[model samples]
Target: MLFIQNIYLNKFLIFSSIIYLIYLNNCVYSIFECAPQETATFVRISRARLDGTPLVVSTAGHDLTCSQYCRNNIEPTTGAQRLCASFNFDGRETCYFFDDAAAPSAGQAELNPNPSANNFYYEKTCLPAVNAHEACTYRSFSFERIRKTSLEGFVKKSIQVASREQCLSACLKEKEFICRSVNYNYDTYACEMSIEDRRSKPTHLRMTVDQPVDYFDNNCLNRQNRCSQQGGNLVFVKTTQFEIKYYDHTQSVEPQESNCLQKCLDSLNTFCRSVEFSPNEKNCIVSDEDTFSRADQQGAVQNKDYYEPICVSADLSSSTCRQQAAFNRFIGVSIEGQPVATAQGVTIADCVSLCFQNLNCKSLNFDRTQSTCHIFAVGQANANVKKNPSVDFYEFNCESQFGGMALCTNEGIRFIVNTKEPYTGAIYAAEKFSTCSQVVENAKQISITFPPPNISPNCGTTIKV
Candidate 1:
């Protein structure tokens, strides 16, 4: 196991097995800053080859030398000055560089693992700690093992491995495709690498009680960032589509619901509060208004679904907001104050968004019965805030003190930041503001805040921070 650490210093130590590194230095503290040289880093995946035609291939003796080669080269074939994002290194010599255009999905590569083939694949990343799952201890990886079942089809590769461990190891090391699930036959010692799993291909999984085959779906993929790592998950409302009554636009997309949501999340300079997607028609309509924003505008739509992102609010049970501004929910009550703004129809989410967007909007009241949204400059402490059975009140948290807009991390961790807070958590550092910068201009200088301590699972894995 050859490990390379300290890329910024341009030096590396070759490790036989594992390396424990610890170092300290004085640096400006921020909500997104990393402790210098505190953790051992490894960039290359052992015995793994990324699946793609290399943009450039050259011979280099050392791993560090190959790394430099990738950074120095440009897309000569296309006459474009594109830098490589990843590279494959054959242990001895040979370097294959791949540009961003040819890069794999965020947090994934179509890696082919070959025990006989001595190869290593390295991708440049700012958050090496978060993305270095392959380099972590084998025990850190996990899978949902199901007995008497097998996910059929979509098998790109199958091989004979010694045990369940080796089978899983091969799946983890594969580079030819995103290996989502695996089928292992203990009797035949056959390992099947599948690109689809129960989540993506729900119907493909079948019961095989007679066979000695068991299905194992990789859990690591479930931890991949969503909501741009903004600490929220997509709430799918089935058979119910939001009507596009405000700031709505239509686009053609793949027939996947997630792709439709991606359009909403990926919108530039605009907040896509909701989306209506039709898988059958491959149509997506991203809108700034959801049912809560304009309750009368939405109705049932067959063959389509609505999606909205819900941000993680403060948990008063476990942590306090230091009495600094915080999101607080009040049921059966409404803030009574001079209206900053009022809408005829709105929901709690709409009220939250309105309060979040307007710097002056510190508190809001939503009347469920009347579907009315009222924003206020005052908060719950105001004496006028009185009981109203149909009204729900929400106050803007610290987001108002700073002009922080809602942003997502590459991994879908969400937080409101008006200024760049140094990332104090040591879990990860992004190569750049990976996903957020694409949606917000000049956002590369910003860093993601710590996500919730626990991510609720949709595909059977809870990520604990």
Candidate 2:
């Protein structure tokens, strides 16, 4: 028995020395040693500067002498105290501090054979000292183990999740969780998915594990009232007449919605606000009314009761306008610096119309001051007023043709005809016939001698003339 006692003493001394060293480094003032009657032991330091305010200390085994201390303070009062009834572990008694200032009373320690039977052992083996700069050890537990009688508003529902992916997907599907972090207990697979405005950050879903399971109170599903609610079949909000409406800038000018959409895509200006188009009228209206208000209806125009017209106030003079060119020779339609003819007097509109009518005219320049016209008959229209100048400018009329026939080339070959019918024969002569003999035929009665028939049959018949 003596030998065994000595061996235990040596072990206790060694353990105490290690605790002293830890106190030195961590600047802990108070230590708590607790061994619940449970299988896994738990030791805690009630007050330690370097040691977190609540610290756990336990030997690898249940052997005692895990003394906790404050720096340079041997005031037995400053030393660690026992918690619960002083139950002897192995042979030595476990101690804990009641408060930071009071001395530990050995008599007050009672033998606690059973500290609450339901006490759980968190698997965090390393009890780190709390520092202002350091992060506290966070315990994660599932809702199943956590005792919850009731929850307040804000947390609406609690559910057990299989994986982190399921938790995240659930949170995403819920519109209420627009901004909030999701806390999960991997042990219980219970998730506290909070719905908050700041939940957009993904860090809320992070999950870490300590060795042993811990209990977590799920406050995510505690809320009585939801952030948003679903109505019966309607799923829409009621609006007043003062609600403002927005539209696209090209909407008024486009003949159809499709055309307006296309124009919006093609426009270079980014300030275009909304588009309004009418299919019946084939008109599109594009406007920039950013600060439009429905209440301010004085200057607004109402169109067919469907839309209110916000005035498109723009400076017409400040608009970037181009003049039409009138002459061809003045500005070569193909090559630069080539001589071209100047057209006669014509207005800018008339010049454009003429250019549209002429098939060969690419563009024309009409001079407002001189009333002169310059038409581009062929090639690209390159007319500049400052340089090889023209008056006004217009693009050429290029119409598509079939086969090799140029429909717009000239006006001569405009029509064609086809014929298909049965045929009948008829003959007519218009001249009189004449005789071959005239006065020369006076010996008309003159007979011509004929050769006598040769043979015996002819000799009898010979006498007649």
Candidate 3:
């Protein structure tokens, strides 16, 4: 028994000596190591605060302590496990930790830079490879700085660039995609070109306190380019209707097509919905009827094009007007039909205003998920709506008419006219009348025995003076 105990003791000593030597050489203690491995990285922005309800709020001695506290905190509310994504240090004692649920995207947690507030915002970001480090000493680009703000989810392409100017230049020169915004990383020297802007993706504008990055919008896009490229103001379509005459308010000889369009716009006395310019005759006809209000009258005419104001820049507003038209709001409903016109990167208020501004727009369908606006002229019956949680429907309760005044004056004799009905009048090319009384006399000679014409009987009434 004594011999067996001695042998066992010798075996235990040998095992202990081997384990200590291994520990000395590797310099590792349990799962924790003395040397650096992969660790979390954060971007610190001064005088800023990430806007959200804190998931875990506690007092800490330092910002690092607060960061560690957030890293270990499990979401206490939803029972489903979620990790902390951001935190706000008050520059004094309080630390506010936020989970992914509180701020789903970094863009949603946009930092509000307050001049008076002395707070620092931080967010977790992707770390470099193990044992790899970025110098993060790249020169900062100078321009109109929207500090700490990042545009998310609209990146069309990503490339390595030396400076922010090159990034912006790359976006401007991009021919494959319509680049409207750019995100440049100072640490990685990466340029991310985006197809959308803040006006297009307002909600996607997020606070990027997790990485060293800058954002810029392509303000070079002017109003004319906007009107031409995106159908910002006027939209042209083909029509063949040639028999329209009663709706014509005025006709004049124009040297150019642009002059004809300008004449229609300058008509304060009459609401001109469309204009027909004949290149062969240099004849311009301004009318109150468009292809939308009078869809049945549309037909192809030789060497003539029809233009409608889908969106007027002067009249378009991002404000919701409830008094002009009665609208029924369906939060989760979408109208089904071929849209008369569609506009992208607009808000709900803008969509409502667009529908109200258009004479032909009977209803509108807005996609909350995509921030798109759809205008409908016809086919908005009850059966067209479907269940869509991300869509909202609104229908304008009003009659479709170009309600305005008309002025016809000769030798200080002025006559004003107004109508709210479709045109119904016969054209007499052979007869010539000098005055309003002569026209009345001719009408009396032709239909004296007949009762008043029921179709727009009050359209061409005139008084003899």
**After aligning candidate 1 to the native by TM-score, how far in Å is the CA of 117 from where it should be?**
43
TM-score-based ranking: 3, 1, 2
TM-scores, one per candidate: 0.25, 0.17, 0.29
Model 1: residues with Cα > 4 Å off, grouped in runs: 1-132, 135-141, 222-465
Indicate the TM-score of model 1.
0.25
Predicted candidate 1: what Cα RMSD to the true structure? 26.2
**Clash totals, every prediction:** 38, 70, 6
lDDT by residue (tens digit), candidate 2, 225-279: 1122321110101111111242222234554545653453333322222334454
User: Candidate 1 lDDT, tens digit per residue, 294-367?
Assistant: 44445545776666554333222222233322454555687766888787654444455555555566677888
- Winner on TM-score between 1 and 3 is 3
lDDT of the candidates, in the order given:
0.53, 0.30, 0.53
Candidate 2's C-alpha lDDT? 0.30
Which of 1 and 2 is ahead in lDDT? 1
